[model samples]
Target: MQRGFFVSGVASTMAENRLDNITHNLANVNSTGYKASRSSFKTVLADSHLAGNQKQTSSASYLSMGSQYIDTSAGSIRQTGNALDFAIVADGYFQVQQANGNIALTRAGNFSRDGEGNLITQSGFPVLDDGGSPITLPDGEVSGTNDGMIYVNNQPVVQLGLVTLINKNDIQQAAGTLITTPESNTESAVGTVVVEHGALESSNVNAVLAMTEMVATLRAYESTMKVVEQYNQLASQLNSDVGKIQG
Candidate 1:
């Protein structure tokens, strides 16, 4: 697998993976609370250990995709003027209960009240309160304070469920805009989060940058494929010449 063709094969696959990620970022450029993914690279040796292998074979080195992480940077907050919409100005996530009774974190706060007066997300998941219970609001001019306290007509209702992650890497994005982390990675962030009423957080993906990277990745992939193709042709020609000489 240390041959030039084999290395080019791996390179092509890696480029395709990068292109996929870039495509996803571009697609979600307008999505609410969307975080873009970033890819990393690492060098390895075909002798099996670049980190600890004492072998001095520089020609056998290989490149690989190291890791992928969700960029947790905050996006622009836009005022929607809708009372149900909310935005977290700082480091925190909103908690919502899933259909299977599991909890997930999200930054998308484009919420609305159900017919039963329960505050739910756009996906219909009931939003949790500071006490880890569903937030049931009474009708008539709903509002929230900067500290996530909800009040209706100047009467207190409940506080939004705000939590923070201990390790940024612990957050894993799920289907749609929802994300989850292990229970050990999360803690109640009651006063740590600053919420804005009548606003929503846009995606952090930069469209122009992503598009440029997409083109670059595509070109790199094509170049690797050409190398692989050229290698195959030369290999075939060499085999044919060797057989003719033997005959």
Candidate 2:
């Protein structure tokens, strides 16, 4: 295969993936407690040998996506005036029980109650307390302190589960508002994990920046495509002129 074809293909692929990533972030700009992701990469050989050719050019190496990491920085907190909604003021995640009896971490605080008065997230997952158990609120007015302690009728009911990742990079953005939390990667809250009741955290995505980057990526992809077209044209000409000529 032509070296330009290989290079162009890899380049265009990188741009396409980058565009998809930016689009996802922009789509969730209004999502509560949503954290944006940024791409990182490293150079790697696309193919060591191709079409029985043993020698390859230095240009065969291309930039490959090494990994993606969330921004992790806290988003702006918006006051919802709803008692059940809460926002984390800093680095920590709220624990919610999934249908599989496993826990998923999230920063979204738009919580409500299930039929049994169990505190639940918007997706209907029961919220966990500090002791790693589902919290069931009694019938009464509920309130919370900055330290994550919940109260009903002036009596403490339970403390919310607020935890921090031992290494922030260990987690990944999962389906809709949930984060892939590894149990071993998490630890009890360290430092002051402030909680703001009656509010929710806004997504950290910057719409303007994302749109600008999308435009740039699209241009890059187009340029790479043009290069690939040129290579194809050259191949056709070679087949017509060189491959057909006989001495």
Candidate 3:
């Protein structure tokens, strides 16, 4: 394959990956406490030959991994009138107990109580209290405060676990979600996260921008495909012409 064709092929692939991420963010725009994700791109370095004496120069550009971006920007808080719904007031995450016994951090505040009276996200993951215990809300009208206290049956039953990231950049995003080794990084996890009841966070993704980028990426991909087809046709014609001359 021609070097130009190879470069265009890689660029198209990278653009498609970025488009996928943007599409996902737009799809989850209405999700409660959802955060928008961006894509990070890095240029691949050209191969280096043995240096003569002083220095070397780059030849061609390549595509590196397309990193999933985490938008730490705070979303707009909206009141939902449901006491179980909550929103973070600052830089922190509400820890939830995943099915695999691993803790996961999320901004999604739309929560509910199970038949066992356990406070959990809509996905059924149990929300954690300040002590890392499952919060159990009683059956009644509930009220919570930004200080991390939830009142049920006129008594404080659970305190939401609000924690902040010490090294926000150290967190890695994989499979369209953020994951970290919570035990390995102690110093990076410091201040407690804050929670406000009766409210939920909105996604920061701009739908208009996402849609525009998606359309542009699609067109670019099509153009690259056309180039590849032209190359193939030219190569085929050259072979046919050579055979005719020899015959």
TM-score of each: 0.92, 0.90, 0.83
Q: In model 3, what is the error at residue 28, expressed in angstroms?
A: 0.7
Worst 10 residues of 1 by lDDT: 48-57
- Full-model lDDT for every candidate: 0.88, 0.87, 0.74
What order do you get sorting by TM-score, best first?
1, 2, 3
Question: Which portions of model 1 show Cα errors greater than 4 Å?
Answer: 48-58
For every candidate structure, what is the RMSD over all alpha carbons to the true structure, in angstroms?
3.2, 2.8, 3.8
- Which residue pairs in candidate 1 collide? none
Q: What tens digits encode model 3's per-residue C-alpha lDDT throughout 151-186?
A: 976788777876777666666543333344464442
Pick the winner on TM-score between candidates 1 and 3. Answer: 1
Q: For candidate 2, which ten residues in a row score worst on lDDT? A: 50-59
Ranked candidates (lDDT, high to low): 1, 2, 3
Backbone clashes under 3 angstroms, per model: 0, 0, 3
- Top candidate by lDDT: 1
Rate residue 73 of model 2 by lDDT.
91
Output the better candidate (1/2) by TM-score: 1
lDDT of 1 by residue, 33-142 (tens): 88888888899776544566476545567898898888999999999988888999978899999888889998999999999999998899999998889999988998
Instruction: Please give the distance, in angstroms, between residue 9's alpha carbon in candidate 3 and its true position after superposition.
Output: 1.3
Error of 3 at 166 (Å): 2.2
